[model samples]
Each structure stands twice: as structure tokens, then as C-alpha cells.
Target: MPSVIESEVLIRVVEPRDLREVYEVESMSFTGSLTYDFSVFLFYYVTAHDLFLVAEALGRVIGYIIGLIEVRRREILGHVISIAIHPLYRGLGIGSKLLKALEERLTSRGALRIFLEVDVLNKPAISFYRKHGYVISGILKNYYGVSDAYIMVKEVGASLKQF
Candidate 1:
């Protein structure tokens, strides 16, 4: 049940040339210390290119999601490092599309579960994750230096049909 605009967005792996637009989306979606600069995006491109993806529409980058796979106590886990859509494209289902695309990629790579941290004040983001089956597992105090963050997780095992 995606809208026409949502249908037009193409989710694809991140490329070196997409970093500038991705950084612009990040800057528009976040503020102050919460925003990651171009260098961080470049680092992710070099270290975890496979898990990073972008949402392109009309030949321009409109959103992106960054993820990483890690082994924790012998369990392979997927981490959503960051996700953002341009301010003008907020409620068109682009974020959900980006998230689902990343989740499928991670699950295909043997991730048992997926995790992400969101600012406690971001109600829209929290709601978005919740709608996608993520639940708050814990809280990180002062995660943003000025506020707290909620650690959200969703299982991506074989039993989950969405995966």
C-alpha cells in the first residue's frame, strides 16, 4: 500500500558519489551534535559499504540508511547506525522502505536481530520503529550528551515472515 511517490523511490546500495547528498539529508534531518558530517559517511562507505544504502528518486538522493553487522557473544547482530529522509519527504513511506530494505539485506547476511538507538525526544521516529515491530529494550542515559536515547530491537530470524 505504498503511495505513488513512495513507489518512485529506488532503494539501492550506497555509492561513493552519493555521500554528499546523503550528508545533506543527514544535516537536514538532524541538528547540532546529532548530525554526522561527511567524513563519518565516508568512513562508513569504506568500512561497511555493503550495509549502507540510499533512496533515490528522479535521479537524486532523497534519503539513506547506514547499518553495520557485528558479532556479539557469538550472535550476529545488525545495527542501524543512522537513517534520514529529507525534511520535505518526511511522511511518504520512504523511511520505512529504506529500513525494510536494510533489514532484508542484514537478515540475508545472517543477522539474527537488528538494533538501533533513537533520541528519546523523537516521537515520530520511535513510532515509526514501533510500527515496524521494534520495541524498546533499554535506555542509554545521556546518549546525546544533552538527552537520553532508547535502544530499540527487532528480531529477524527465520520465524519472522517479514524477513
Candidate 2:
């Protein structure tokens, strides 16, 4: 088997101009109506603009991740809103890098825990989160209309480490 080359993936804060390509990557990474529309992305940007991030290689946007923070009572909760990588960029560790970036940002802002919802059928994503120390907290019925979703949670300071 040939060795895998880990390309240089530059992670950075998302800019207004990057939305088009980010949406394209999001569309490619998901199927059916699960893909987020531009308006939803815009809403996330407007609400948590500082938490939006994108990964680039050779001047092309290859992956992206967005997060939201909420302070409930006294604890800061971090929510992984969305994450996607271009089909060609999968298995290159770009997603991992992007996730780490978001986690670091959340931690810097004093997030106590981080969580996300993933489609139950997406085994690869479930495995990825599990490797990152996320546990299944519960299930969201009909999270995607006809499909259910798994609620995954990870304690920020415990599991998310610098890479």
C-alpha cells in the first residue's frame, strides 16, 4: 500500500467572501436535504461569526467547521454547528484539524463541554467522534425528518487537546 501524504492544511477564521466555496463544500459533503442552505450558514455567521472556520490548501477551501456558544446558568456550553470536508480531501486529517481549531476556540472562551448531533447512519462520523472521546448522550428522534440522530458529547478540557 502506498503511504498517505498529509498535505498542509491552513486553518483560519471564515471571511464573508469564503461563503460561496464553503457552501459548495457543504453541498458536496452531504446529500438530500440535509445540506445546509446558504441562509442557514448566513444565520450561523451572523450569530457566531467568530467561531466559523475554514481549512484551505493550495489556496482552495477544502474543509470548514462552525460552532456556537451558550452560557446556560453558569456553564458555557459549546455546540458544534456544522463541519464538512471536500470529497477529495477526506481521510487527510483536515477534518480533525478543523475540529481541533473549533475546540480550542471554545475552550479559550471557557466552554465546559462540547456536543454535536450526527446522523445515526454515518458510521464514519460516529467513529471519528468516538476517537475524539465523545460519548453518546442520547438520541434525537426524527432529527432529519425521517432519520434519527445520535447526540454525542465530550468534555472540552478532558478530551480536546492541541494537535
Candidate 3:
């Protein structure tokens, strides 16, 4: 089953029409965490569409990643604002593919580093980020208004590792 899911995965740019499904996946992915509302997704889509991506399987949206790139302190930084793979799609390499796609897009736009915050208690997510070469940078207290989060960063450019 895992092999079959992996084989049919397709990565593509996020379109306005995909927003609903994207939000649905996000809601599912971060059930207890702070998932953004539709309005927030719209704001990001309008401003940072290039950094948004979605993964599809059998023509259904199965996962997505929303990112933002900004030039801060003269260094272009990419922030993984949100990423979610439907629970059913877990362990099929979709998350890694989505991350790689977003990183590649950011790198092409001269981003020097990529960062994201993960719930401190989500060990699987923490491990996943580490596996992709992201290191813990700091902690944000009350990141979800109830729990803390760890900021993880991965250097892009020449040091970026391909999955």
C-alpha cells in the first residue's frame, strides 16, 4: 500500500482552487495545534503563491506546504509557514517531496536558509525535520498558545542536501 501511494504521488504548484483542500489537510495535520484559518491561507496565497505547493494522488489533494520568502538583514530567508499531509498519506514520502519542492523553489529565488516551528511534543515531526538536515535553533514559548515549539532551520545553497 505504501509503495502504491508513493508511486502515484505528483507535486504541483498550489492554485486558488486548491485552497479548500489544502486547508482541510492542514486542519487534519495539526488537529491539536494552531492551524490557520482560511483567511490566513488566502493572505499567504495572494502574497506568496510561488512558495506554496500541493501534493496529489489519484487526482486528489493529499498534502501541501505553504512557505514565505523574505529578505531579512540582507539575507533571503524561507519560512515554512505550514505543511500538512493527510493522515492517510503518511509514510508514503509525500511530506519529504513537498519539503524538497518548496526548498528548491526558495533556493532558486536566492533563499539562504529555511526555517519552521514544530510543536515540541511532536516527536515524529521533530525527527522528520532532523532527518532532512534541519537543526533546532530555539524555542518559542506558547507557540500554540498552549504548548511550546522548537524552531528548526536548514541551510540552503551549497550545503543543501537533496532527499
Candidate 4:
């Protein structure tokens, strides 16, 4: 079931003005090397505007998800470059909303599969992805320098379901 807050939250394409608030969410959600610099967000905004989205509630940016579409070996793939919800909004279904919106956009753009990397130690994230129908396909050692990461993938077709 969706929470009242989730129902109130609006998911939309990210605007240039939302970058700062989006960066704040990113900083709050991650630390050290895991956090992306503001420039990286700007780059994504320029290069993948259609794939960048934000969750707005109460007139502020509460979360954001950035993705990229790539063609490799005759396959169109979607990559979730980054996703983060403000600490206060973590469990209200905002992340799921952001992810669902991204997946829809990617699939429409011909993405046959979606991929993301999560730290091996992040159990909550692993479980979240699993619930969304993603499966761990492999592991990348030293993915985070100080830690490893699990590469998870989900096929984008009739099997995809909404959270």
C-alpha cells in the first residue's frame, strides 16, 4: 500500500533549478567517496536530461534518480547511475516511485535491460532491488575501492512490475 506521503509526492523530470536540492539529498544519503560531486550531477543533467528525474513534495526536492541509455553489442541497456532520497523520506515509497519512473522512461527508449551497482554491505538496498525484480548477476571486487559491489540486473519487458 502507498503511504499518504507517497501519494502526495510528485515525480517529474529534473529541472536545472532542482540540482542544488538534489545535491543536498545526495550528500545526505551518501558519504565519502560514495557521494557524487555537484559537477557530476550537472553533467548528467546535460547529457541525460530525459533520464534524470526528481521527486518533489511540499515544494522541495525529496529525491532524484539519474540513468543513462547505452547501446552495446546490438542491445539497448539502461544504467542507473545514481539514486537517492532525503534521509527523512527514505521509506515512504519515494525511491520506488523514482525507480519506476526511470524504468518506464528507459524501456520506452528501447532499453532491453536495466543495471545498477550496490555496495555489498548495503543489505537494505540489496533487498529493495530484489523486491523490484532485480537479481544479482555478478560481483565487482574493489568496486568502491574500500569495498565490493553487487551488479544487479532486471529484464525490461512484460515481466516488469510496478512496486
The best candidate by TM-score is 4
> Model 2, poorest ten-residue lDDT window?
1-10
Q: Count of backbone clashes for each model?
A: 0, 0, 0, 0
What does candidate 4's lDDT look like per residue over 1-163, in tens digits? 2234778999999999999999999999898999999999999999998899999988899999999999989999999988898887888888999999999999989998999999999898899889899999999999999899999999986656644
TM-scores for all candidates: the values are 0.94, 0.92, 0.92, 0.95
Write candidate 3's Cα lDDT for 1-163 as tens digits: 3434576888998898888998888888776537788898889889887788889987778998888887888988999988889998887788999999999898988898999999999999998899999999999999888899999999889866556
Mark the 10 consecutive residues where model 4 has the least summed lDDT.
1-10
Off by more than 4 A, model 4? 1-4, 161-163
lDDT scores of the candidates, listed in order: 0.91, 0.87, 0.87, 0.91
Native-referenced Cα lDDT, model 4 = 0.91
Candidate 3 stretches with Cα past 4 Å from truth are 1-3
Give residue 50's error in model 4 in angstroms: 1.0
Off by over 4 Å in 2: 1-7
> What local lDDT does model 1 show for residue 17?
88
Better of 1 and 2 by TM-score: 1
lDDT per residue for candidate 2 within 45-99, as digits (tens), equals 7888889999988777888999999888888999998899888888888888889
**Candidate 4, backbone clash total:** 0
